[model samples]
Target: MDKENARNTTIFLVCMVALLVFYEIFVIGPREKQRQAQQHAVAAQQQAVAAAAPGAATYVNRAQALAGSPRVQIDTPALQGSVALKGGRLDDLFLKGYRQGLAKDSPPVELFRPEGAKQAYFAESTWVGPALTPGPLTQWTLASGTVLSPGHPIGLTWSNGAGLDFARTIAVDDHYMFTVSDQVTNHGTAPIKLAPYASVQRQGEPELSKTNIIHEGAVGSLGGQLRLIAFKPWKKQGDTTFTSTGGWLGITDKYWLAAIVPDQTAQVKAQFRVDTVNGVNVYEADDVGAIRTLAPGATTTSNTRIFAGAKKVSVLANYEKTLGVPHFDDAVDWGHFWFLTRPIFWLLETIHGYVGNFGIAILLLTVVLRGLMFPFANKSYESMSKMKKLAPEIDIIKKRNDKDPAKVQQETMALYQREKINPLMGCLPVLVQIPIFFSLYKVLYVSLEMRHAPFFGWVQDLSARDPTSFVNLFGLLPFSPASVPMIGGILDGPLHIGVYPILYAATMWLSTAMSSQSITDPTQKMVSQLMPVMLLYFFASTPAGLVVYWVASNLFTVGQQYIIMRRFKVDNPIDSLIAKLRGARTPSAAAG
Candidate 1:
């Protein structure tokens, strides 16, 4: 039996290692090569474009792009930027509340950059019609206000040489929403058709998290259904078009959004497209309203709203409730388990509101969850404790039937049935914890509130990986271990585990070890020992808040199991270690 068990363990380990090697070589290696090739192609294309056109869209800086166009100032409480009068585009804006980095002096988070800039992103509203219509290059004259702000709107106007006149009024809320109203008056002898069109365009791909947990790309709600397309797929698929009466579409980052919401009652055609201009990929989400015929001496008006800023849950929910934007809160990437993730975020936020610290709130939330699951966990631990007490009887059965493995198993089952102990009862708590763990992980990964939220003692950003790496002895050393040339990358990768992960690993080991004593199979015992170590590496780069939650949960489980073991008079590692320590101390006490 022992030989067979050892063989099975060896085979299991070998298969796992082989699978990992195959995945890395076949899956990861090819994808990485493809990504590198794409990057090189883009670089070559940029160089070609720059050579062909000296002052084209080839990496012009933001300051230069902003200076190349005349503009009207935007000075709202939540936004600061200028609208380019050249195209009358909301192409330069910053979020006043967020910074590019965690440092106090870091620049305000930029939401929009002008056309010629590298990675330029902006939103624009225009009339889609004749060649003379106010388009990207048609210079507009400011007619009304000098500054755009809440309760104050600015007007811009343009005219076709033939007699078609266009006027645009742009207004902003105290927050991130912009209201763009466009009016066209046809004074020509003949009738002309025009449609309102709005687009949010992004030039060049921004840095992405590259994980499947949260989405970062084109997103929208059209015809009552939500659509999400990532960058690669968006390029591959070319253009996706939809016709919906009332909907919203946009390009989204992990925590930021630039969406266009058309009139709730108007039928419009929406599209998400990726185009290569001057060798740079430009991603756009746009909507065009139904065409209206402008007769002689007649006018038409259109209103479109643009949402560009942070994806705060409350803020999005408020927009959904007030503006009637469908699934606006879905911008947060709540995942398929939104039912659980949303409630978890709400509870965490509420607890933080009262406690004044997210870390403390997480701790209290764990306690509350454990309390809710107390009955189920109590039964599981009780069954485990009872099973531990039956270990001697099971061992005797094994010894008595040493030659016949079938008899050993038969008698063990008989013993369990006679004792009314359900061997599977111990798995109930683990099954219940799976969804809760993922839900909490999603909350920590995507919630804006968790971003840069500080916990006590070194955990300044709950959403970021723990910074005090074990490679640098938890930052006690003067030098960074990750800075040591060739091996630095490895050290900074999985080997960059920190204090919270170590604590989590220790608690997991203790909890698993406590339960593992009842597991008699050698293969099961070996797997039990390896699982915590494997998870330690897997979770080393996860958000610190999630590690903290796991640590607290494991501690709670250990304490609860210890109490149940004591009640059943079952021997456990904690009691055995305490006994050995007392035995060792007796000699010292006598000598003293």
Candidate 2:
């Protein structure tokens, strides 16, 4: 049954690949052509209009400067930051005020709120010194109420009783990261016991209406609007290692670093806590332990760095010294496939810097990635070559063992041992690359660097689908339809489709054909075929960058397989397989 299922799965995979190829060739290609035609038509119309109106040139000049004036009005700093994070709001800490263009259309890189809504506050005790505050951390939006009234910005400040310069300038680029430091000091004559608990809360506003997108399964089945992406800690974890508390500190892909010290010679206990609060995240680091005696003037300090940003492998690897955290580096989840995916992204980024065409970069990247993985592909092909060479013997085994399962297994095992071949040996390299494949998926999804970026040629927008549409008397259509009504052209039916998806599907099919074998089991084969089709459907609406990665990966696989077959001197896997089957057919084959 297992064998049958495996065979069926193989077949299904092959079929799916074939379907993708067909879609790319027949549907997507033509659609892309139609889109190009439409674009040309629009360009001509624009040209004619420009020519007809002498005042059009004046209008263009006015609009051009008008466009540059606002953006070039002031050198408002380039979106500066090592990373960017989007802030989501929940009930506890709602985002109020002019949310007009804030989070309505795009994700929020910075957070803004009103004084009435400043229900949450972050406070920590640090040694009285200049090291703590070199400069003020700019707030994206300050509380209007507080700004109108007398007093400083809504924040906390501690007096440096010890009289030491503890100054540090840490900038908060995006709403993604928050920093917390604690300084335990003997300010009083006697020993002091202090456990600081920090909380960032969100208060509800009755009058202000908030704009938010509802994610599926964000708040369980109940499904409420997502207000903030925060996490908290409920219980303390350890001494000097407080459970990372607050919504942004101790979650997956949320990296946190810390340094703590006890009083001169005494030991300080710090416990990190993390927990969920009604879907709003909170994390707190409590300073544990008490100073027995200050002995006049003594102080201790703790420093921490917290980063809540996109899960990019290289970025995670950059801080590996903190700890070899998994899923943080350039590692893929889909097994061996990542070996190809990671490199593909790297190459595309590299080429994009010079050529400025993500699409072409992807094409080049695919070529390079395939060259790198060619050795594995060659080994696989060599194995298959050997298998094919031994197919005759294998057929004989099948003929003799029509029903002897036990004998078949024994003979096959003996044949493999004799030939110094492991039937599953070829599978390792393929499996190893799976992680790279999965990582590629994640890389494409999280990297804002690729957002809305364009590629050359017909792909003016690599971030979105190549739109091709025609509107008939039947009103406008969402996408260009493949067919129209009786008047057909009247509805301006979609005559052509986007070629990229189809091209992607084709590339997958070619790779599968060269890499995969036909499965004998009907069910498994069916599954194999359905996999690619399902994938095609999934990829249809995904970001073009992701699609580009997959396409490149597939093409690389094909090239790698070709190299493996030609370069590797390994025996044919099929020929060996055949010999094993034939050997199993003999009743006393093992005796020899």
Candidate 1: misplaced stretches above 4 Å?
A: 1-49, 52-57
Residue-level lDDT of model 2, residues 1-74, one tens digit each, is: 33334355556556766676567545765676676688579656655765686543212332332232111010
Error of 1 at 302 (Å): 0.2
User: Which 10 residues in a row give candidate 2 its minimum summed lDDT?
Assistant: 214-223
CA lDDT, every model vs. true structure: 0.88, 0.40
Q: Compared with the true structure, what per-residue lDDT tens digits does model 1 show for residues 32-133?
A: 657768978977877677868855566667889999889999998889999999999999999999887788998999989999877899999988887378
User: For this target, which candidate reaches the highest lDDT against the unseen true structure?
Assistant: 1
Clashing pairs in 1: none
**TM-score between model 2 and native:** 0.46
Please list the residue runs of candidate 2 whose C-alpha ends up more than 4 Å from where it truly belongs after superposition: 1-108, 112-115, 118-369, 385-429, 447-501, 514-530, 538-543, 559-592
Candidate 1 Cα lDDT to native: 0.88
Scored by lDDT, model 2 comes in at: 0.40
